[model samples]
Target: MINVDNLSYSFPQKDLYNKVSFTLEEGQHAAFIGASGNGKSTLIDIIMDPERYMFDGKLEIDPNCKIGYVSQFSQLDKTKEITVFEYIAEEFIKLQNEIANICTQMETSSDIETLLEKYQEALDAFDAIDGDDFESNINKKLNLANLNKHKDRMISELSGGEFKLIQVIKEMLNNPDLMIMDEPDVFLDFENLNSLKNLINSHKKTMLVITHNRYLLNHCFNKIIHLENMEIQEFDGRYIDYNFSLLQTKIELQELAIADDEEIARNEIRIEKLRERATYNAEASNGRALKARVKIQERLEARRIKAPFVDIKQPNINLANNNEIEETIALKVEDFSVAFDEVLLENVNFEIKSTDKVALIGINGVGKTTLLREIFKNNNDCIKINNDIEVAYLSQMQDEILNESNTILQEFYDAGFETYREIRRYLSNYGFGEDRIEQKIESLSGGEKNILQLAKVSASKANMLLLDEPTSHLDTYSQIALEKAIQNYNGAILMISHDYHFIVNCMDYVLMIEDKTIRKVSMKKFRKMIYAKHFDKDYLEIEQKKKSVETQIALALMDTDFERAKILSQELEALIKSL
Candidate 1:
């Protein structure tokens, strides 16, 4: 169990948390959610180590409880030349070494009895910690991820997605009592994401997850802790439930504030009338009536309630609507192939209509981003676009487009606004006040950069938009607003995103890149097809058989039975060939 009381933190610019408190019971899973720059990640850091952040709070953790943490941007050290299996079984190897050392001491010690006792103790510790099952656990996780073939591969050679999966597998091997995962869904494909979900659900340990994936939050977490306006609100349900309840609470508070304001206004009017009468009779009266009226006003002031919380206004994204198109095809690709160190995509063919809204989706390391960049390059005849059509591309690294040295006002001006007043008015439409307009771009948070990019794109006169992972850093409300804006856009849109909710709501057609080919399908049909593939009997059977062989091989290797491992390897090869 973990408990926090009256936690507060401050930075140079703003206070992140103020008098926040919450408790997580043992074995409970919860999610922390809020807008970007509202300190969700900072709160996690404080909980992990309050003293490190110098936060003012009271935190309590159960003694001797182990924690496993997976950060959003964790990367493998390229200098460390270690195999995937060795990395995952590191703790078990340490325990084995300790036991071996104790046994070697027992061989020639003068105090044989004490040495024997120590050896036995070491063995018991190993068993108590489930060290014997480490190999099996590692193999099981790898096989579930269809990564058992790479068990002996160097960690430094793995792709970003593979490295992330290895880290998650290592954490699972630790069998920690508490697990904290931040943005674990970033590089995962749909199949791997489901694998991760199953892995998380199978473990009963307490978990705290921070993710922008609505599917994960709604399916995995039972409780929510929302951080807003330097305050925290706890809800005893999933994301959908919490959202509904929050909306209801906001409505009630708004009504109450309106009623209180009307009452205060009426009391003020009465007070003014009483003072006027007193002033008219000043010559004949002693001013007792005026004093009484002043006292009544004071009483009324004491009864005034605090106002309701109003959310910061989201930026108004207004995409240009261009209905005129001389050509029917906005974009077309034929026999498109791209290769770097290895072949990523091959023989892909697709086309986009003038007013089509299409989504490009594929597994991690399958070249979704590469394809977008290739299209933008337009180096060959394989890709074609309409003549004289303007295209606006928003890369995954969209934040890098901003000039750090320039102020927001200057940036807007650089985007082609003529006068300061015009730029100011445009910025205001995106929720930027005078103070924010003067702030430098370097000081802006990730979410703020995203909003600025959106504003720029929306203000562009381009007839075709290419967006790559555009919603990754946006808040929930901003994402919804963007979806609406995209829906209202009259031009063609071709976007690459892993956000399922955003894709389903914004796109009508799907362009799935797999097996070196591009297949065009409806979004609904694509979802059903993926679901069917996940539950196919033959696929499940093959996966189970491979998992069994992999587990056996791992156990044999752990026990130093090389002959047995060789035989199991043959069996694995045969199974693969049969599949």
Candidate 2:
């Protein structure tokens, strides 16, 4: 129930929205997607608080609408020591306590008028959200998200993904008319990501989500609002169908562009001949012909195809090792146990050989990050590392490796860059512009920070890497590029990740945490385990087949094998329709 018309906004460094317009109607689940640093979050801010900005636009929000917003980077104050139930009911509890205090004051106060007015205000506010049933509502939401067991737990005890879902449940209980989430799926584990998908699917009210998560985009939204090239394209369909249509359009446009290129080449030759005749003959007729030919060439050039949406730039991530290590144990853990208040993992043992790429995976809050950090420190008696192997570590928390107070240039300098020019040149491959090189690292977006981590890690040239959730905040294009880099890295890797697609694409084997112990499994076994837990066994099988067919179709089309391409396209269509 919001409409934005003719909106144009920009910052001092770059332009964002240029006469962009879109609408969010009731019962619509819209995915707001775009490249990183393209003003998706800024637009959300403008919608939430328009008075803070001075821009030329007509934003018409329904006067009676209630909005709920979840920011991209939100953290709980663990020092407060509040339970999940109490945290979700904090607003209602405040209003209830205020009403009781006002009533107690009315018992013996001379300023009865003031007390009565304040009491009425508190009562009305409490009743607006049905405070009488707030506890029941909170319980129901927790049950719906399958988080009933965590209702009585302390907020500090929950994992990042669990806390995020708790925030969503808290917002839902507010009975908002519209809910907006900015990258709610950024760092969630697979199970938690699926929980979010189910929550979005079951939501009755309108929602607008800004995320680069392909899983959520495929499974949750009915509408797609894509911002590209400083404009908007709204599609009233599933993202899968939209992507298919985009692929077909790109192929057709490429064919037309090929023909146009050929025609332009011939036109250029004709113009050259006419110019030569005009110079030799020195006649008015020849000169006029040359002028006409030149105009035609200009017209053809102007009409050449330009596919802005089809051609998106990706970061260059090359994690190539500078030196090779002998075939030896890169890392080994023996009889290790980690605990804070209670044991989470016990008697765990694992080893990685030089040049091996292995994934250390488990559900959220299962000590994966903890164990990885301990290995990086190499101080524990139970852990062993080879002396010849150089190590690089990438933490999911950017602040652990990046200095927030330092500029990008300074950070790179600390990362061992020799000069400012060299730092700028290296950072450009990761999509950082020269204008942002002098800016503080704290000012960059989450996605930008993650890309900077990749750049820094690649520069280390270490023979061994310990990466934790390396793809958390990256966009889809950057994710693909990182996957390629990981696949080609000439080093040993022990990565902690919950991104199924990324893990399957990059790692060679799995070292999974199960029942408080570490166990290694083959890639084939890991695939089966995932499919059995998360989907039908045939789900990934069919998807792989469809991808193979799509590739074949593209190659056939490129080779001008129209009949073969048509056959493959039909097969692919059938597979998609079955899905």
Candidate 3:
């Protein structure tokens, strides 16, 4: 449905795309993935409105095609006081209002030509969205997303994740020829994220999504459009398959690179000997041999192997803890109840021991963020923190911790850095280049802002961390690095996250909020819950067996029992095949 050929675009700061070509056919769901600040959103904007850009490219879009876009930063005005249905139907309402206004004007004004043209345009737009059935379509979308009960609720009453899903419903109901969503799954809770995955899988039209969400990436897309180093590649397969192929290719390339390095080393030694001999002998043949050796060395250097799509820069995320609290409880909450218009959580109790890595999880708008903030403040009667434990907090909203107007250098300065050179050296570990250090925080991408937050948190040297949705805008590479950091941290962590992969990777246990109280769940039960909800019932059992067999194999190998290890290995392979 969309074809981009030899598209070359650049920003004032750097080149983004160079001769990039890709195609999205009808019914193809494509994931537009890349590192942060790589112009994924900018490309989407260009595709939506190519006339606004002056670039060398051929962008062919169907003439009759309609597009529905959900921007990453699009937000509803909470104070607008409109119902969810009214908000979703805003476009239909506008077209109807415009048609009515034009008809009224045409009846009195002498400018009949202008009024008629306006009326025709409004009518066309209205019909394009099937204005007659707009309400029904909205209801259908809400039902599909399992949000029909919230149709009459005020838009301001919705949580961030709820509102994000509402935006998806609105766009899906518009029945566009293609839907383009930018990071629509960024901060969604687990349930809402599942709803979104279902919506994507069930949609019968074309889609182009830009997200770093591994869950959605693995389950939703049939095509992958990867942008790296100003080049784009299209893969026509599942993300899991694509990842395996990339891994295989990377291994092959690394082997070739090692061989190339060895050959170059040997050639260098040979060239050194040839030159040494040529320096002593005045023979023409000796000089020619040295020249030939030098030429061969140059060719080897020029032909050195380099791995493709495997060198993307990853941030060095370090969450430091110097004071390791061993025996004391890091934090405690008892009989905590928070209320706004109504009681959200009541009589909640939880505690984190020193060096414990725990996840605080609940549905969106279940007061998870509020609870974390209260713990951070530590002024309430229901909260108690150990005197020896120093705390650092990472808020989900970047504005809460970062000054948008300040440059990276200035921000680090405010964070207690003594010198600009020191700040530059520190930020470099988080993938901030020298040229980007002077740029204001507002200009950085969402992922970059999160990286900056992590950097600041790391510098705090606190023994306890209260993190709220810490992985919200981090790209996949940064997310993985953050996972490793969390795993290696000696400090206690009470993190609120909806990322299943991250939670399983880094957290030792879960503190789940249910029915206005806290319930501690083991990782095994958490895995069971996830598997039952998102996968087959047998999946968890099979995974457990696989883990057991692998452990057995490892023990057998350590004991020098080769026969036992081979038997356990075969059993592990069988379990994996079942999965």
Writing each residue's lDDT as its tens digit, candidate 3 over 1-579 gives: 999999999866678899999999999999999888888888998999999998788999998898999877766577979999999999999888989889988889999998888888889889878898898888888888888989998998887788889998889877899999999997788778888998999898999999987668778999999888888889998875665444445445655776898999998899889889988898999999999988988898888997344454679988887887576788888999999867889998888898899999888778888898998888999999999999999988788999999999999999999998899899999998887898889877788888999999999999999999899878766786898899989989999998876798899999998887789999999988877776555754564455456445535544545567556655655665575
Return the TM-score for each candidate structure. Answer: 0.76, 0.88, 0.84
Please write out the lDDT profile of model 1 over residues 482-520, one tens digit for every residue.
888899888889998866656877898999988977899
Per-residue lDDT for 221-248 in model 2, tens only?
9999988878888889998786666556
Q: Candidate 1 — worst ten consecutive residues by lDDT sum?
A: 534-543
The CA lDDT of each predicted structure is: 0.75, 0.85, 0.84
Clashes of each: 0, 0, 0
Instruction: Tell me the lDDT of model 2 at 393.
Output: 94
**Residue 365, model 3, lDDT:** 75
Residue 283 shift from truth in candidate 3, angstroms = 8.1
Ranking by lDDT: 2, 3, 1
Q: What ranking of all candidate models by TM-score puts the best one first? A: 2, 3, 1
